[model samples]
Target chain A: MKRKYFQRKFDIRTYECDFKGQLHPLALFNFMQELASTHADRLGFSVQKLMQQKMTWVLSRLHLKINKPLRWGETLTGRTWPSGRVGKYALRDFQFFNQTGETTAVGTSSWMVIDLEKRQPLKLDQLFTSDVSLKKRALADDFPALPEIDNSENQCKFAVRFSDLDLNRHVNPVSYIAWALESLPEPVLFRHYPMEVEVSYRKEVFLGDQVICKLQQIQGTESLSYIHKLFLEKNGQEIARLRTLWK
Target chain B: MKRKYFQRKFDIRTYECDFKGQLHPLALFNFMQELASTHADRLGFSVQKLMQQKMTWVLSRLHLKINKPLRWGETLTGRTWPSGRVGKYALRDFQFFNQTGETTAVGTSSWMVIDLEKRQPLKLDQLFTSDVSLKKRALADDFPALPEIDNSENQCKFAVRFSDLDLNRHVNPVSYIAWALESLPEPVLFRHYPMEVEVSYRKEVFLGDQVICKLQQIQGTESLSYIHKLFLEKNGQEIARLRTLWK
Candidate 1:
């Protein structure tokens, strides 16, 4: 039988909030990631252990649906478990709730095991075993193909610094999201609640690597929804595409 | 009689470490700040409550001496209490210790309660009532005036983004430190450990405001050290002046 999901609890801090006194999406993602890593460590598959073997986990995509608002000083519990592998991707799911057991949000992510030396993907089928049965259900209705905007505007250039590097010694995903969001104007930032987020991490960004974020804003089929496409300036490489729905 | 010191414990996370696997100076400072804030809140002078009165705590200067290396999963307890007031500055002190009761580092800070609406400082004499009796102990040996470098090199410009804004809607000190450190070359970053840090915050920066970081390398009488100055690009208004001693 599969073991119970790993759970961790924390109270949000003041600095984690934005101008509106609301919890930031970046902070939410970080809480889930911390729980995931801690859970993996208990299972003897921690990031540090993986790094020693020259294998690291790289996130490919994440989908989150927020059902409630999280604010400062609220005690919340984050629970996560490895659902199963979807083809070449290792899948994991997360759920957050308040003290009253009310669900706040749910998230699902896909990660790939990368051999650091070879810089290539490693198959998970033969590499590991788990007691939890892989859930066949997809996280979202569909993972849509982001729009291809030929013409775009370069928002800004971000230089990866020491604080941006994670245990794996590369630019972390939260930093990528922050850089992409910086490309938008202030009005777009404060206007809406992010209903859904999609990310496809293309390549590993390292220290001293210069990354220029280019953004192309498009209208979503639903009224008032906005879509932003992020790309690398030098090679025209697509980093990650994001979409947000307003209330 | 004085109240006992407020203490909080936390395990350093992997992301909070730098490339060398040691805890980042920024992260260490943040931990202390968190402890101070929580203490203030327990004393009924929390940032939120102060903001409601059109006042907020502003960090003026901080001096910390690192005697230990904090790594991922290492639990450290932060203890803080009111030391005393030096003229217009209310003094607070912090000391960190490991699980074995070994002292890791000590920190002292000066803070000002600012009238956010009037953009002025208010005397702390009548503002706060803490059970902890103020002990007359200077945080540092000498709070020296930063070098007035007539001619310095402008390193780079950092535009204040949403990520830089804290709960008070101002550019946080951590962001300021990051910008200042960015002025230094990589060789300086990895070669030495930061022994002493002194900062003088001059003016407030907001979102969309682009600040320029300037650096001037100087030889210290004791050993090796560096000084960095930051300012506004357009007005040339000073933001912060920093000094770091290396071992």
Candidate 2:
């Protein structure tokens, strides 16, 4: 059934590159949004129509690992599917492949239905049913585990700038990777691919707040599977912790 | 100095919007990148030279505020400046204004100088230092403060998808706002003339982890804000938190 959903291809544009001349992580999210929205449309549901009904789907969580870096003008394909559904929540997966079909990155997302009018959560039965199936095979087995952190000795600091906020009036999660990765030397970061990352949010960061990010390398094989923790700290207080894996 | 850094205005493009047809926050970051890079060239320091010298300026942190939603095909002036320098870091500022000089968004970023080859931090003395007196004076002073989050109750959760990750190999911050805002009813989000937001990064979100975002109304004001926390429960333990503010 997953095969029913069409695979989409995209080309990275020049504008998407950072000073280092690589595709920005946020841009990839934009592409995935397009792919998911298009896939939903193909499955007989339109995000627009959902909005009209005061019903929206929110992404609840995500886990990703990148094996190599992608550059500008590179052609890539984002293969996505609705792997399964649990009650009102739906499980979707995506695989990013280079032109040669080698997997560059793999990810999964869980979405839930919301009632926009009441601004409240809605049951899956209230929105979608078992019939809304897109019988695609799961992307892969052996999904990496979430990174482990001590939660102690985590002291990463950052200042929330005006540009870090998004239209929803919050800091975007993808920006966190940039900040965390930025802490590393550019040469190591540029040469190494992000093997895996698991990010969990605890608090919201506001403008002018000095944000603190803390990290600890847990365990890994060939750096492709190392664990790390991230969080924001203010005046020695813990805000959030992100456990991540990198290759 | 701000006046000197301000160049001719550039119009916002339609391609910048996400599925919700609103300007993606990261688009603004990209604009800032373009404006700053161009401004850097004007200041006689091209990205190429910076790279060659093994000295690169990384965006250590950022905070952003959006006062109004920008629509498709809207023309706005993007003004940027090197507000000041602190040791090996330079503080850059950006403002988006409409034709009437009405500010739409204001942003600030802290950048650090790194030795790309040695993969080490560079001291301010090792890099060029000129009194940014002219640029500092040219910067606008009356920028708005970052938006605040009102409550933590009634939060929404989202999962970062594969597309959410960019070439930078992590979730893009702008995608977080796009996803969070898209979760809202379209009519309410699109109709308002003036919308304000402030976002900070606490942790990095990757594909497959669940992110919980909470939105609440500010008291005695028409304004609203949200707290986004991205996390996953394996053995029933919390992972990460991402917070955001929107009005």
Candidate 3:
């Protein structure tokens, strides 16, 4: 039987770290995405393979929890596996470990198979029947609808660049989190580090598009959370919404 | 004797590639920077070591030529070495090779040792005496001054985000090029690929700073060239200028 899991090791580059010498959240997300793609390719379900059938994968939502902050020059092993399915969504889970084999982060993500021509979600069971370890889940929480931001305290505008587009021709999902983080207040950004992040992608963003990120903060007894909403500047269409917790 | 040259191998990640499935220029630059830092660390001249002595290395200029475009999922070996010192500037060079050992890209960069407190350039001879093979140069051309943009044609404004800053608490040099590329015509960006790029960094950009990138095209006899200037939006301080040849 084909192995249901994939593992890849990565060395943290200096450019991947922030001023605090810790790995930036965006870099971590990039690593996860890379691992997921590689695994999908190994399973004969790569984007190219799906494209041949006029179907492509679209990330719907992701929830990541970082147990420890990864630092520069540290080598980490990323392990990912297919984690069953829910309705039209395909579930994947990821775990990141440090050099000493400590779990640094764990993530659960939901993706949808989409018909490129019709621009609609396709049923997963028809196209995706790969072996998934239904019992193994990195994160215990199921994919839930995130709360909306009550008020926006800060915001930033961004013009999508060519570099922001990936091989799929749409804006890379990691860029959304990068812009969301940028919309936070200076004190919140520099004083704290993100320990958890949940992102829900609503619409596709392309090159030459202008987007604005709106940030709203919520204070809790245990942790501080911020909700970020990214919207198309031209039509006010929602692109993505993210909730991040800092400590 | 310590090895003067450092070599590292990297697997191009899926996220690092563009719509063409070729590695992005910014990713190539990031790989070069990572290789350079690793080499410096091995030579006991890392940024941390320099910071201990109240000094730091600042990139002054760089010229990179891509003989062939690198593609996603390909393994490339990057080799970098300290070439020599020219007056107050220390010269380093880089060469990238594909799995077949074909030279894919080459770059030469100039750096200066800066006194952190005084913000002054220090003499290369005073603090740096590392073994450098003066004869080994990746590129034959001397570090030439990059041309300034004549007239602003396309422009984009950006606010420095925390993610843009590296461990040095300043904007990574690669981000400057990313912004410069964003300030170009869509046809030029999507149709042509940059074959050669030269950049001269004039001023440092920090967090919360707003900057604007202005692009100017220069039609040459054989090739099309574009000049990009990134300036501080508040005071109009020229941060960096880049010249790129696209084919």
The TM-score leader among the candidates is 3
Name the 10 consecutive residues with the lowest summed lDDT in model 2 chain B: B233-242
Residue B150's lDDT within candidate 3 is: 68
Per residue, candidate 3 scores C-alpha lDDT tens digits across B1-247 of 8887999998999988888888888888999899989998988889888998988889999889999988888999999998887888888999999999999999999999899999999987767565555568999767777766667778888888788887678998999988887787888889988889889999999997999988888865578888998899999999999988888
Full-model lDDT, candidate 1: 0.76
lDDT, model 3, position B1? 82
lDDT of candidate 3 over A202-226, digit per residue (tens): 9999987999998888766578888
Give lDDT tens digits, candidate 2, residues B1-247.
Answer: 3345655465554335543456766677667766766677677665556867666555554556777777655777888777876666677788889878898888776666667667566876556666542345233333233344445445444545444554344566566555455444434444442244344443445655566554544455455544443334333233322334544
Write model 1 residue lDDT over B22-129, tens digit each, in one string.
888887788877888888887778888899999999988877788887887799988898787766687788888999999888888888999998988997777765
Cα lDDT of model 2 overall? 0.58
Question: Tens-digit lDDT track for model 2 on A32-132?
Answer: 66677677766766556687777766665566656676886588998887777766667778889999989987777667766766756688665555455
TM-score for candidate 1, please give it: 0.92
iRMSD (Å), candidate 2 = 8.8
- The Cα error of candidate 2 at residue A45, in Å, is 5.1
Give per-residue CA lDDT, model 1, range A42-115, as digits (tens): 77788888988989888887777777778877988988888777677878888888999998888888888889
How many residue pairs clash in all the candidates, one count each? 0, 78, 0
RMSD of every candidate to native, in Å, equals 2.6, 12.7, 1.3
Candidate 3 i-RMS (Å)?
A: 1.1
Ranking by DockQ: 3, 1, 2
Q: Each model's TM-score?
A: 0.92, 0.49, 0.97
